[model samples]
Target: MRAIATPGGLPISDPAALVDVEVEAPQALPHDLVVRVEAVSVNPVDSKVRLSANPSDTPRILGYDAAGTVTAVGQEVSGFAVGDEVYYAGAIDRPGSNADYQAVDHRIAAHKPTTLSFADAAALPLTALTAMEALEDLFHVGANSEGTLLVLGGAGGVGSIMIQLAKRLTSLRVIATASRPETAAWAREMGADEVANHHDLGAEVLRIVPEGVDYVLSTHSEGQIGAFAEIVKPLGHIAAIDDGNLNLSPLKPKRISWHWEFMFSRSLFQTPDIAVQGRMLADLATMVDAGEIRTTATQYIEDFTAAGIREAHRRIESHGTQGKIVVTR
Candidate 1:
């Protein structure tokens, strides 16, 4: 199998940061599906791992989002077959989807939406899963939920899908934060009821919702902890996906319920409800087919070579990309 991998932690500008290699195709485990990968998307985690990973004799494959066809199925796999087309954010512990073939747990993979091409479907898994888990599991939002929800980093991959999911699945009035004019328009296109400039987050959001929002989903929660505390309503829930040295004392006075949402948690821990990812993805497919949601793939590269992969990573590292960037074979 042909794959792109990082030799070790190196700068993206370095040619050795990502290289092409030939390796044996992976085989399916008892509950796994061996997929023939067709397309993949690059996320922030890819760059983080590439930079932070220690140097090793063996190169590490580093893709999480993939859309592919199942070429073989493990003995215990039930919902998927050899010919099924699937999409998933493969477990972080295993070799990732930046290869010709990938072995993924069937419990976390779902049939790709029939309405989308492989490139488009590839863009959804990781971001969609993050948004879905943050809203449904962490925040406990549903159809009857009526409140103003604020989304930070609203034009990024996860936030793009988050806005659409909130609008389609729940009655929550969504206020998304985007600093630039283009990003604000993109957020509105994704179904955000209002767009606030993240540069002045507290003031911008408070201007729109004077009483403060009922929930906050912080996609890029680096230095905005204090702003989140000031803008969110008392007793409201706050969910964050990013990791940093957070000073959480500000939210303590308001009794705010803080939640950390990591989409890989269930698969990483082999949780009892790990299969929920597959089920939720299936439901998302139904929604996609029904036109309730749209793919967030804003940038597409037809080349799937190492250079192409490197360019995708560079774009993600640029920190200015809107929505997802996909690379197809």
Candidate 2:
């Protein structure tokens, strides 16, 4: 199998930061599926891990979002068999999806949407998992909703998918924040009832949704959250994926409920509830197949060559991408 890995913490440049290497083919575990990876998507976590989670003496693989075909299934695995198409955002704690073959826990994987291509399917897992975690696990706000919500970075990977989910799954009115004209338009196209600028986040949101929002999902900088406090409903909930030195003292007056969404939590700890990721992903797949949701793979750069992957990373770092950026083999 072919792979790209880093020996030390993720290197930013040169020195084969993400060098090509050949590794032994992975075997299906008792409850695992050996997938022949066809396409993978890059997320902020990919770069973050590249910069932070490198192995000391050996190269660490970096990827989490993948779509592929099951080549083999463990004896203990049920419900899926050889040649079953699947897509999953794997555990961050495990070796990633950036390879020719990967062994994934069947409990945390799902059948891919019959309508989407491998690259498009790959783009859904990570971002969808994050959004689902934020809404279903952390804040538990998507179901049976009766309040207005604002997705602070709704044009990004997680936010892009999140906007649609809120529209289709909940009764909540969604207002998404996007700084640029293009991004704002993109958000509206994705089902956002309204759009505001993240550049002037506080002012823009207030102008459109003056009464304050019931839920605020900040996908951008934590440093900008103080002003966000001004627009949150008095008893609203707030969730953020980007962590910085956030000074949340201002939120005291509002009595806001804060939450953090990391899709990897269940997988990282090997918790008894790890199967939730698999089940939730399956839910998303059903929605996709039913045409209730759309793929967020806005860009695709072919061939998993090291340079191509680097360029994909570079684009993500630029913060100008509309949705997910995929690298395919």
Candidate 3:
């Protein structure tokens, strides 16, 4: 099987950082699906792993988001079959989706949306799963929930889906943060009720919701923990995906509840309820088919070459892309 991998951790700017290689095809485990990968999407996790995690003697594959057709299934796999088309963000502990074939746990894989192409479907899994878990699991948001929610990094891949899910699935008044006009417009296009500049987030949000937002989901909450504390309402829920040293001192008075949403958590740990991710993807597919949600694939890499993968990583690391980037074979 043809694949892309990194032999050692190196900066993205290194000309030889990512390379093409030929590797053995993966076989299905007892509960796995061996997928013939057609398309893969790049995310921030790819770059982070590439830069930080040391690769084994066999080069390490770095993609997590993929849409493909199941070529074979393990004995215990029940929800999917050999001919099924599926999309999933593979477990971080396993070899990734950047290859011609990958073995994914069927519990976290769902049938691809019929309305979308392989590339478009590939773009949704990782980001959509993260967004869904953040809102529905960590924040406990429901269709009847009523509150003002602020989303940081509103136009990025996860935030793009977050905006849509909040609008379509819940009654939360959505406010998103984007620094540029184009990104702000994109957030609004994704169904955000309002968009504010992240650079002046406190003021921008305060101007619109004077009492402060009831919930804050900071997708890239690295240095703005204090800023979030200042803008969130008392007893509100604050969730984030980024890992950093956070000081909860300021939020004590407000009684804020902090949560972290790592989409890979269930699969990474082989949790008993890992199948929930597959079920959520199925739900997302229904919403997409019903026209309540849209694909976030704004950037497309025409070919699945090594150079193309490098370019996709560059765009994701730049942190300026408005939506997801997909590379197709």
Candidate 4:
């Protein structure tokens, strides 16, 4: 099998950051699927791991989002077969999808959306799961949910899908934050009812909804916690996916609750309900096929080699990409 991997903690500009190597094919473990990877997408976690994970004698594979065909299934797997087409964000503890073949736990994998191509399907798994879990599992928003919801960093992969999911699944009025005109337009295209400038988050959101919003989804929460506290209504909820040294005192006075959403937590911990990821993904596929949701793949790269993976990492590190970037074999 051909794979691309990082030597460890090297800058993207270094040619050694990602390298092409030939490796033995993986075999399915009990409750796992050995997939022949067709397409993969790069996420911020890929870059973070590349820089922070320890150096190893054997280079580490870093991709997470993948769409592929199952070449073999574990003895205990029931829903998938050898010929099934599946998509998933493979567990962070395992070797990743930037390879010709990968072994992933079948409990977290689902059949790809029938309406999308491999490139498009590859872009949905990680981001869609994050959005779905944050909205439904964390915030507990549903069809009966009402009030305004604000989405921070609305043009990025997770935010793009979050906007669409919130609109289709809940009655909450959606406000997405985007500093650039192009990103603002993209946010609206994804079903945001209003667009606020992320550069001036508090003022922008206040102008649109003077009473403050009921919920806040912070995709990039580095330095905006204060603004989030200011714009959220009392007793409202805020769910964030990024890691930062956050100060919670600001939200304390307002009685606003803050929650952290890490999509990899369930798979990483082997939770009892780990199969919910597969189930949610299956539901998302049905929605995609029904035209209720759309893929967020804005940029596509056809090369699945080391150089291509490096370029994809560079783009993700740029911090300005509008949607998901897919690299197909």
Candidate 5:
């Protein structure tokens, strides 16, 4: 089978030499579904890993989000068949989806939305799961709300979905941060109640959530989080996808809670609740089919290859995309 993998530590945006290799085909494992990848979406982590993660032993396939067809299933699998189209963000601990065919645990697999193209479905898994986990699992804000949640970097993939989810599932006033005018507009389209500049987070958030906000979800955990500590309500929660060495002392007075949403924790640890992803995916499919949810895909390119994958990575690195970028096979 063909795969785009990194055999050495290198930057993306020119993965032609890094990717584009022929590898042996994968075999099915118990409770695993072998998918013939039809589409895959790029995320920030893909670039970070391609540049930073060390794969000393062998080539590392580095993609998590994909939409494809189940060509084969392990003996223990029951919900899908050989021809059933599926979609999922493959587990972080295992091989990724930047390949001709890949194997994923049954638990993390979700049916593609009946109304969406493969590219659209590919964009949802990682972002939707992250957003859902940040609210429903980490903060206990599901189906009920006492205060508003401010989303930082709300024009990106996870943030875009988070804005819509808060609107769909909770009554929380959705305040989002976007530094650019186009991004601010994108955030609003995704259902942000208000948009503010991320550069002046404290002042901008104060204008919308005057009494401070209930939670802050940052897509990029860049620097000086303490500088905006005043904006979070006392006993509020903070969730983030990006993690760097940083201090948390300023949040002490507010009794602020912190959550790191990896989105791959269950699969990485093989947790007892690994099946939750599958259930969540099924629910999202249902939501899409019922017109309760919509795809966040911004760019949908065709085929899975070196040039296309490189372009997707470049788009993400440019940090200008308002929504998801997907490439189909």
Candidate 6:
């Protein structure tokens, strides 16, 4: 198997930051499926792990979003079989999808949408899981739910799906924050009812909904906690998926609730409902086939080379790319 890995967790700018090498294929565990990866997408987590994670004796493979075909299945795997086309966000604790072959827990993997290409399908898993969990599991929004949702960072990878899901699955009046004109347009394309500048978040939101928003999904969670606290309605829910110091004192007065959404939690902890990730991805696949949810892969790397992967990491670290960046064979 061919793989791209970081030996010492070096910076992306380093020439040897990611290297291509030949390695033995992973064996399937009791609940695992060995997948032959066709396409993979870059996420912020990849860059974070590459730069700051503890170095490993062996090179560490760093990728989460992947679309591939199952070449072998574990003894306990039930829903998938050999030659099944599947997609998943690989578990954080395991060797990831940045290789020709990867062993993924079948509980978190689902059949890919028949309507999309491998690159497009690869872009949806991590972001779709995160957005679905943030909106439904954390915020308790559903089909009948009617309220306003302010999606922070509404033009990025997760935000792209968040905006679409909110509109298609729920009755929430969607408001999204995007600073750039192009991003704002993209957010609207994704089904946001209104788009506001993140620079003046409070004012921009207030202008759309006279009262505060009922829910806030902070995808880009840096320095926006205070603004979220100030702009949310009393007893509203706030969910975020970023790493940084946060102050919750501001939320106390309004009796607001805050949740941390890490899409990898279920698979990482081997939770009882770990299969929910697979279920959700399957449902999302249905939606995609029905033309309800669209892929967020705005940029594509034509070849799966070390240089291409490095450039993808560089763009993700720069924090300016819209939607998702996928690399395919």
lDDT for predicted candidate 1 compared with the true structure = 0.92
Alpha-carbon lDDT, every model? 0.92, 0.85, 0.90, 0.93, 0.86, 0.91
Please give, for residues 42-66, the per-residue lDDT of candidate 5 as tens digits.
Answer: 9998888877876565778889999
Clashing pairs in 4: none
Clash tally for model 3: 0
| lDDT winner | 4
**How does model 3 score by TM-score?**
0.98
Order of quality (lDDT): 4, 1, 6, 3, 5, 2
| RMSD (Å) of each candidate, 1 decimal | 0.7, 1.6, 1.0, 0.8, 1.4, 1.0
Best of the two (3, 4) by lDDT: 4
Candidate 3: regions farther than 4 A off: none
Q: Model 6: how far is 102 from its true place, Å? A: 0.4
lDDT of 6 by residue, 1-329 (tens): 88988876688889788988788999999999999999999999998888886777688888999999999999999978899999999999999898999999998999999999999999999999999998779888799999999998889998999999999889999999999999999999999999999898878888888789999888766777788778999999988888788887888989989899999999889889999999999999999999999999999997787888898999998988999999999
Worst 10 residues of 4 by lDDT: 219-228
Error of 6 at 1 (Å): 1.5
TM-score between candidate 4 and the true structure:
0.98
All candidates: TM-score: 0.99, 0.95, 0.98, 0.98, 0.96, 0.98
Q: Model 5: runs farther than 4 Å from truth?
A: 13-17, 55-57
Q: Provide the global lDDT of candidate 5 against the true structure.
A: 0.86
Task: Write model 1 residue lDDT over 20-136, tens digit each, in one string.
Answer: 999899988999999999999999999998999999879999899999999999999998888889999999999999999999999999999999999999999988888889888
lDDT of 2 by residue, 1-329 (tens): 88888665655666566778888888888988999999999998888888776466678888899999999999899889899999998877778887889889888899999989999999998788877877777667656787788997788998899899888878889999887889989999999999987778888888988898988788875567677789898878888888877778788898988887777788778889988888888999899989999999999999787777777777888889998999998
Provide the global lDDT of candidate 6 against the true structure: 0.91
lDDT of 2 at 27: 88
Q: After superposition, how far is residue 107 of candidate 6 from its true place, in Å?
A: 0.9
